[model samples]
Target chain A: MTLTATSPAPAPAPAGPAPDLAALAARHGLVESGARPCLPEYTRRLWGRRHFVTAFATARLTAQYSRARLGQLWQVMTPLLNATVYYFVFGVLLRTKEGVRDFVPFLVTGVFVWTFTSSTVLAGTRALTGNLGLVRALHFPRAALPVAYAVQQLQQLLFSMAALTVILCCCGQFPRPSWLLALPALGLQATFNTGLALVMARLASRTPDIAQLMPFALRTWMYVSGVMWSVSHAVRGDKMPHLVAVALEWNPAALYIDLTRFALIDSFAAGQLPPYAWAGAAGWALLAGVGGFVFFWQAEETYGRG
Target chain B: MADAYDARTPTVIADDVHITYRVHSGRTAREVHAVKGVTFVAHKGEAIGLIGSNGSGKSTLLKAVAGLIRPARGRVYTRGQPSLLGVNAALMNDLTGERNVVLGGLAMGMTRRQVRERYQRIVDFSGIDDKGDFSTLPMRTYSSGMAARLRFSIAAARSHDVLMIDEALATGDAAFQRRSKARIAELRATAGTVFLVSHHHRTVTETCDRALWLEAGTLRMDGPAADVVAAYEAHAKAKK
Candidate 1:
């Protein structure tokens, strides 16, 4: 295979002078960037690639329903189907809806809100592992994957939220001034979901087994989160242990769900709301949002490596 | 090409770089040291061929240079963001080839307008759109070779400061290979450095000006393309 040894391997041409790499980099606007980008820079890069995030999310969402018989209808139908099943199992069979006014709407609201968190968290686990090929082949912010998944779920949730509004009206809960509050409630929930998704993506990308165990974990969380039944009613008059009851009441998921129910369900009263529901929502969002971002960013460079 | 080898024009430098990967054998975990202390300087307009046996860390070295992996020790410095040629690796098989082109372009840091303007050229380069609506079909429907060609085409659309190609040309036909060779030459002419990893001695000798021969995670030879390739072919024949 040798080319007739026509020219001896031209020895490396003499290196004229040692170049100052730092100065050279400065002159060329280059940096040693193989390491994890700093947080501020990463955020800036992420912002710069915001279009990619939305584009990716839209692509995934469209493809997700591409093969389904019901097509995009399944996005709204999946949650409504779950709401029905939960209404049967918990509301009718267990009579878990006892003492809860506008029980159907309450159950629907909880189901929709909880789905936002559970779906995002589960999808986040697969964000990196599912796109390992992309991660390996492309150079971009790894956070884009999880964030895109979260956005996809948010898109899906927006569809389900429309369904929730119809369910609310049919159940005699008309649009009230308080109904306006679901906006901030969803905003907080979305922020919280994004953070949790980031954290879960990092963990699941490393272990992978976390994906298998996530469903069971999320199921338990759903029970405690009052997805189908009121946490307040479940623990009312010391029916459950004091500490467990308090934990359920203050659970971030439960708090967000309760806030939505208070806003949308006519029977749900603001007085029954947790004293610091708004504070709790903001705190959880900040804790998960800021903390998860840092947590995920700290190991940014480690992602997609074998 | 006057100052192509000038030290001041160093386009890529790997400083005693090492890469180790954690692998599991059954239930036992172990670390495989893929690249051990490889140090080299590539100048502007250089076409470097990385030749090695299977698992000799040719791909790993390229990946480390592309910033896909942080080496266990030492560091790699590149002139700019290096685009590894398997951009199709990032393509979603479920999506149509057309969508993959757009997504792949965005991922490669091309603006929307750039991708839009070059869409026809990319499709022409890949030859997938010659038949009506073929690019609209899902990538999973395409053969592996077609997919590789498409990826190469998309990546080659943009001139990169540092480009790493891993066995991309091995899948294409003679005509495609010739076109790719010309593309690499053109890239180097534009002062872009390219690292080609391939086991095809003929391909390496023809496409690259210099060659690095790796054996079992170490650089066994580094010299002109023909010299290192001849030594490598002889070593393989002897082993056989």
Candidate 2:
């Protein structure tokens, strides 16, 4: 993949050095455009390249396990290992004395869903800076970078979800027909993730420092989101911990997973949910989704800078 | 052959654009004037080159013109859209080159179907062989030339009202340069404009019809590519 900088000997070689690319582009007025890049225009541009997005996501999923002895099995093995460890640690060791029959399913479902949200938020935040190559050389809507990241993460989650469903059903935990409702809940989770991604991708581009703290943030969020232990169970059903109580009332990942459980798990019933929880979770999704996108778009042009 | 261009409709116009960056202090923030009161015009089918020393504000001026930076004062008006090209424009190492090219194409505003349709054209132009698992490999493992090839293919594959290229072309092979130049000419002939930024004097003289020498964000020289490039080259040589 040579650049062809040495070129066919110009019929007559200019005795002096060749000018740099910058001088050449400007001298010709390519940079002379004064028009601002509109967000819709940029978005439309990204839309045109959707296949590239899907292809990239597919490649990322496949390549992640290329070097592992386990190969693509790592995809399933990763979440399995994660669920097992938490199940042992929280379900057995700390136990917090949970009484939600077959807590394993409850814990695994919540963690897997939460992992999707966290991974999307974490990856999307740094999507811009991490892909400086694509951002600078191309003129597509910059949002595609982060959206692509989220989509890639979602692909990985789909595998995890399938494995989770099989595990739960195999364990005599067949869900009610109403469990199909989980799809919309999952969609809302993704919507929230996309929004969070947009904001993070832009902010992370401006300061690489933000990316460094993401893993730690994800870990903290993991605790807050009740991936291992149910907040509803931890505070003993009657009263919830301050953060966990608030989370149960709002966190979409929690709501979405609970929606799944309400349809599947026998303990959960209609009266168990608070009135504002649905509204609050929806609000969370709206804010993160719309706010993240708008925030990122404002810095759309800046990402191209070196 | 020179591009058969229509010069009546302006491709680009930056009206006395002033751009400043703020350096904040605990006491008071100070603005760094990256560019000030700079204006220029470009017409369709013209290749313009910007030549200047490092930190001479050449890149800043180019960025301002590319719509990457908003001017503190005045405005940039384009008859059509402009695209900026850099390594950032081409591929991300974490993702495969193939994905990057498609992404690059899409970023340029082609539809998913359009990217798929042009996939072969872009891949072929990149000239990377079937070896090296181009689909599976991340660009971080690619050689500088490989990266540039993909970048070149992605950016040149599309047409634009205006295109701003940074110092990326210096890394390309001669064949690519020729191919890219022909492509640029093709784009311009179709009512597009090209803005090339480089320190390579010969490329400017050969590829551009006009040249602007940016010195500290000011437009130092704006005229025929041959004349301005010659003056700038002579000035650079004298300074050395």
Chain B TM-score against the true chain B, candidate 1: 0.90
lDDT per residue for candidate 2 within A1-306, as digits (tens), equals 111121122233233223332233444544434333576775666666676677656766776776678888888889988888878888889974366666777888877888888989888877887776555444456787788889988898888887887778866777677777677667777888999899888778766678889999888767766566655555455564577576555666667666656666566665545566556567778888878877887876567453
**Taking candidate 2, what TM-score does its chain B reach relative to the real chain B?**
0.85
Say which docking band candidate 2 falls in.
Answer: incorrect
User: Which candidate comes out best when scored by DockQ?
Assistant: 1
Residues A1-306, model 1: lDDT tens digits: 433332213244224222443344445455564788889999998987777888788878877877777888987788888889989998999998788888899888998899999999999999998988888778888999999999999999999998888888788888879889999998999999999999999999878889999999999999779887777767779678888877988899999999998888877888777789999999999999999899999998888775
Q: Is the docking of candidate 1 incorrect, acceptable, medium or high quality?
A: acceptable
lDDT winner among the candidates? 1
Alpha-carbon runs more than 4 Å astray in model 2: A1-56, A59-63, A66-69, A202-218, A234-248, A264-272, A275-280, A298-306, B1-7, B21-32, B87-90, B94-100, B130-147, B170-178
Candidate 1 regions with alpha-carbon error over 4 angstroms: A1-30, A238-242, B1-8, B143-146, B169-179
RMSD of each: 4.5, 8.8
